[model samples]
Target: MNRPSLTWKLYIGAFYLFLFAPLLVVAVFAFNASPFPSPPWRGFTLEWFTGSGSIAGKPGVLVDPIWLESIGNSFRVAIPVALLAVLLGTVNAWVLERAEFRGKTFVAMMMLWPLVIPGVVLGISILAFFSRVANGLEDWLQTDLDFLRPGLPLVVLGQLSFILTIATLIIAARLRKFDRSLEEAAFDLGASRARVLRTVTLPFLKPALIGAGLVALLMSFENFNTTLMLVGSVAPLPITMYGQMREGASPAINAVSLLLMLGVGGIASVFALTSKAER
Candidate 1:
């Protein structure tokens, strides 16, 4: 095999450094013993990662409760969103790929509109629509509808509006290469449609489904604009971090960011390694 030229090697190294340098800095500061979360590190300590109480020197930090609750809230919203998005997206992909219908192009374009639309706008629209519907319901039914409040369900709805598009695209791409003959053969052999989908179709789409779910989960977790607008009283992790930063810069925020980055990176690495092994 021909070796890469010196110039190409330098470019690749530079590209990786550019991508990873900020993350490296954040990780380093997460362990920094200095009161300030920035440069001029005095020493190294793992207190940030271990402490279960409030952040040192910050009374209102509520590091344990706020951060932990936010993390839970994020997952609570994200997991359901990802699952629902995948189920709906997979069905949409199957229909679009297998069936010839009028206005198919129009339906496809509408499904993709969420990706292009700004998150802020989408959030605002959803909030407005829901608020109107909730008010109508309260007036008509004379009962409070708590689900419309800014919380897990609202976050999931906001996220699913866009995430479903991603899942649809990924699963649809995989479906394009699927052989219809397998399903036909299964039918001829008296296998049920559901059995064929469970045994044959889903296995082929597993990688894409996993990848899409991961993407949806990460996106839901890190989402700021939409979550900010849709979330009423409860705060997710990103919003909490932003509020903390706005109030006053703290190393604890950096520490949390670093830990989250590590968690996400670890998951991605495991997925990659497992995928490679399977191949």
Candidate 2:
């Protein structure tokens, strides 16, 4: 076996630093006492992290309704996007893996097509298509369908257009590993197809399904390029952060980042502890 060269180790270290340096900066600045997000640290402070009244000297972010509302809106968009993506993806994965049909390969390719499309282009396409459809409906109904305009649902649709492909691929990969013999045995035992699927197939796919939903949730929350175009009157966390930056806002953004990082870290720690206990 060959060992990696010293140059290769150095390259790997540099790559990791490049990936994590910004995150480290963000985390560090979240505790900076200065209102500014960057440099010449004033002092360590938790004002941003805890929100309003966290520090008596200034208005705290915790009590800021705008940020709180944006976070709430982010969840509203993310949850639905994840659910819709997972639902569509699971169904697509099931059909692709288990059912034989004409143009199956083509159908699979089409499902995956959005993954390759640039998010901005995809957003534009969805907006145009949805608007046209909504307009046509309005023409027939002779009334308004204002909900069809850019907002949470539109953002969800834009994100789902591609996020579903990721979930589909993940679930499909998991499904491919399933033991068909178990499904067959259930059928041989006079189990109806639906019954066998519910008892055996779904249980086998549960871990994958859960994983896909988690991935979709994260992606939907983080999605920006596609979401930016589709979000008109409302904003998600990422977009909210962008707006704050445009206004020359302070380290509250970093504080939000730190809070999110902590949340993710907490979850990971729990999983780690659970795994170690099981082991």
lDDT per residue (tens digit) for residues 1-279 in model 1: 399999999999999999989888877887777667888877887666665444455422235677788888888888898899888989999877988989999998999899899999989999889989999999999999989866668878998999899889988988898889988998999999899989988988888788777777888888888888898787888888899889886667878898788779976886687456535
Off by over 4 Å in 2: 1-8, 51-58, 264-279
What's the TM for model 2? 0.90
- Give the local distance difference test score of model 2: 0.83
State the weakest 10-residue window (summed lDDT) of model 1.
53-62
Backbone steric clashes in candidate 2, count: 6
TM-scores of the models, in the order given: 0.90, 0.90
Error of 1 at 1 (Å): 19
| lDDT tens digits by residue: candidate 2, 9-61 | 99999999999999999999888888687789888877775746545444555
